[model samples]
Target: MVKCFETGAYVLNGREIVKDDAEAQAKLASMLGQSADKEAAKQGTMAYGVIQAHNHAEQGGLLKLKFDSLTAHDITYVGIIQTARASGMEKFPMPFVMTNCHNSLCAVGGTINEDDHKFALSAAQKYGGIYVPTNLAVIHSYNREMMAKPGNMILGSDSHTRYGALGTMAIGEGGGELAKQLLGKTYDLAKPEVIAVYLTGKPQPGVGPQDVALQIIGNVYNNGYVKNKVMEFIGDGIQNLSVDYRNGIDVMTTETTCLSSIWETDDQVKEYFLIHGREGDYKTLKPEAVAYYDGLVYVDLSAIKPTIAMPFHPSNIYTIEEFKANAAEIINYIEVEGRKQFDVPNLDINLRSKLRNGAFMVDQGIIAGCSGGTFENLTDAADIMRGGSTGNGTFTMSVYPGSQPINIELVRNGAMETFMSAGVIVREAFCGPCFGAGDTPANQEFSIRHATRNFPNREGSKPTDGQISYVALMDARSIAATAINGGKLTAATEIDVNFTRPKYTFNKSIYDFRVFNGIGKETPETELLMGPNIKDWPAMPNLTEDILLKVITYITDPVTTTDELIPSGETSSYRSNPIRLAEFTLGRKDPQFVPNAKVLQKLEVAREHGENPVELDASLAAIYDKIKSIDPEKVVDPKEIGIGSAVFANMPGDGSAREQAASCQKVLGTWANFAKQYATKRYRSNLINWGMLPFEVSGDPVFDKDDYVYIPNIRSAVLSGQPEIPAYVIGDEVKAFTVKLGSLSKEEREVIAAGCLINYYKVK
Candidate 1:
């Protein structure tokens, strides 16, 4: 269904794909004049126009993007506003929308979530920002309905903040990026390569947006085909899809590990804006004739089927038919993978046991959040459930609309009534199912969901607490088809079905009534209402001359997501309190990490108070005694040197773009991270913004837990713009290694030198 180009390809207005490298280059050379170069050809891309419009880079090849607007959810807005407030921001310079969708349920944190919501309203009032009330709309939904515009750029704190299908280029990053925009600082990076996603043929009936997205993810995710690159869609097939169909595919582009995505806009996209009462926001967008792309992914939409991503990850995918062929083998592999992901006694995370006769059974079905809760997906689901029932044999289903407007339309069209009559519960707009806050399945049960992610412990299963449930990602169509079968696994395409094809009529009344439109209004006198759970960030010190770090834990997993770094579900409520949130760092992946990191933090904290920490931690005393023989001056003073802990991973930072993944480590005295390479740019940015050195080491894991790594004159090396810094791994003997800081903008260096982004602004 999806074919990836290993080499560069020439996309002729997005449809034709040339497989050969030499032929593509020759064609490009012929199209351009004799003076044409690769640099100039890159400008022909549609992404270039939007990126260039937002770029403020002094020199070419680098981008200093100032997004037209910014957005965040309850899980992220507090930290972003807090950082901006600390960095001397009085008012929002652009439209900053704070949506309360992630923590809207407030089931766990006892009034903590509500406290954050009130604080967001006050911040929107005082800082001049927009605020969406709880259960009104998901974060991306609000952005799509109000904030997105053609040729405009948007930076969001959530990883899935993609709106490229509507001619808007949206990039999701960590809180530090949003905080940068709040303070009028540029988001700096080298120009990302644009890969052409050439689509052809319309999707067959029963194949939804999630299926197309899963096909793309299954093709590109494991191979790193489009990692950190823009996937520009331009093809004749775009006109065949509805705006919502395109949106469903575009939003899931984050799972492909692509930087962002954009598609050629047509009347359907224009109508999308018109329906939302923002016709003025629509504009024509397409690639230039004979545009050059870094690579290409040619997708035949007609070949796509109802897809399924089995337990533990979204990338671990297989078609429903393919899974049914080797269910036992796949289930056994997932069981083994789950064992490695979850470390607990008697934690039986088994899907093989769920298998009955030759069919797999699921206990729950959920179609919720940005990827699943679209009007088209739900309408088709209701059609499949019509005159049928999701039998009450321990099998249940829930549907959540993306926004109140969508919810109202569903009710008006009778889709809600059909769903409820079929035993599928219809619910309000919430992002709970996507991030493990609502509709969690029972222990040892299997759930087929249409949510965005299915990461370990993502389904609200605390594997460490002896609770484990499996979640497999499937399209809403297939999920409903399975629902009608009494949870017996079935593909929607195989089952004859008809879609209602509901014409969307957007209702703006909900936003006008309940939402607080505070953007562009000045109310600086409004006081911020702080709850007891809301706490100030801990004071961070300047980077020390010589940094001492102990390798606390080594992660051998091929990839480490932000969910593993800092768990979601219940842990999201503590994001406002840095110290409290830090306690959960590596809480799921490695339970020993917090204690080890906190023990290392004690030395740094003690030294800040002018106390010798060698007496508090005897292990540090032994390391210093070893350092004494190496130092010519024999000066290992606690004040001049910073003590911290580090984690070594093959590749870290996938999944969510949560800053807590980095900030939590910073609060616990993490001075640096040693990795082969970071999975996403946002993860590395989060580390740098929190004053943690993002070190890329080429060698294998030569050190273990409690092993010391000493980097001398590290601060000076960073300020001097040295790309590669020398460091030593000290055990009984010293081993030398070189760590590379891949790329750092001028301001990024300043952020590191001053200990953090906040301190950088304070010092400036």
Candidate 2:
């Protein structure tokens, strides 16, 4: 079980927790032999140390940090390098690794996937970077194996870029942030709060890291307990877990919506580096004598049960026991929620049909990606399924090692053979299954996976096509248990199997032979291998004097993820081409979003050419007339106002760090996003980087789809740092509302004014 503290607390000597209440200061002072200074105590945290080490700014609230290294998968590297190249970047400032894991399936888009791989290689050669070839490793796996050093900070363009268990503060951000680092620009941020993940008690034999992670995610995600803060792992319980186990728990921290994470390192961590042949990277890291955390999450490992994150989200969690007890009701609830979420007419999401003889049956089981493909998880899974048969039925299972080295270890230890004996297919080190690219189930079929997320469409079912599938997230152990039982939903603990914990030997030669490491050798004369699919970004226009925004899509969901904004799966093949990718934006969530935005975008295009929007589209005349009526004395010129679309969601940008979530919106002529609040800082930053205003509205603004809201002096207001922005929704009558752009740095404002980060760099 996981418990989040309502108030902040102080940790003494890394083990003792003192709640920060009235008498807590006195107790802290007595322990530390001095008056408790909260501000000074904050500096004693491991997170503060790592952040400050990378920070180039004057010691203050605002941080301008440069990471030790950078990483990106194929889905992101091409776009990131393109943005950086346009922004005048020559050679990479630091180590940059481009791994071809996401787009390894070359047949998906003809030559699109491999063309990107070729382009990434040429970029690595020309710009002095590293390129891990297809199936060599996933992004996080490669980084964890070689790049993550204690006290170092790495920034990657993929979410789940967490390597905190190795004592490295690795963050998953958008491509624009990587582009900034490529151009030697600092990552600007306000100093974030650090939360102590105080661990105690050892986990049960059958309970795995995913169980622990799901427990923490369930406790913190909905309540926003650890949102945008650093989860600093501390206390005696960390010693009970292996490095890989810690890593399994760490990578899933993205679900908690934390900014980044770091951990108290021990000799076990040092040994992990030693096994990976990077012993020199090891450094002992821990908090000082006394450190203050803004919040605390105390997890009792022994109390955690085999957990499951139900369909649609990683936070929709339940214990395997609880789920089994109420299987029918839970499936019904998921069906109802799925109906509301997909909302596609004629789509039948009949999850209850999966029940057979009071037992829930799944069609597939996948142990893949950064979280599940770790050596420890795979080896343990193999032990559980060593001799058991996965019966040749409709139920299928697959295991993808995180990296070639892990695969080699699995092979050497007979884990791979054990998996094959149990009728489990062993796959290459690909991130496909995790993000809807691989192992797509048939309509109405259910899959239980050990992947990072269970978001809608994550299992590759196209609800828009009336093809809906179900996915529930469980630990690899439970998935193995389920697989052995012919896909009957079962907990690993329920099966009495001896877990032969295997010691892994790293095969450094796999990467040494396959990976193209151009770290310091830059071939400037190299030409990038650009296919027809890869295209440069379109020229983005600067912010105009005033803005006219048409609400193209309005979503009332409590949270809207990036996957819904811009879908994953086969559509990801078009990621290099912004216009083509933009066509798919909101395609799954709102099929009409593109066509509607395009219609309004035509008027904007006409207005840009000195033609009145009303002249081009007579339908917008009444909207313009209503705008003029809001301020009858002031004359509104069509040319001065930039017309573009806006999207309103209850809470937008939750999952994924793919910049496409915002870039696709931008490419479709979106000017702003009106949300109750942004789910993550990365999403908001993506919007800012793409030159879209991330406007926060309190409660419901009463704006409907196809409504127009005109904001006069918008560009000036943003540049002038105006807090509250007044705008009028043009309907039967002009209705007024306020939207706030919460705290923009001077550079962020300038970037917005310049239209995008690329334009901002162009001006510089």
Cα RMSD of all models vs. native, in order, equals 1.7, 1.1
lDDT of 1 by residue, 464-499 (tens): 888888888999999989999889998998899878
Q: Which regions of candidate 1 deviate over 4 angstroms?
A: 25-37, 343-346, 631-634
Candidate 2: lDDT over CA atoms? 0.92
lDDT of 2 at 742: 95
**Clash number for model 2?**
0
lDDT of 2 at 209: 96
Residue 423's lDDT within candidate 1 is: 93
What TM-scores do the predictions have?
0.97, 0.99
Q: Report the number of the highest-TM-score candidate.
A: 2
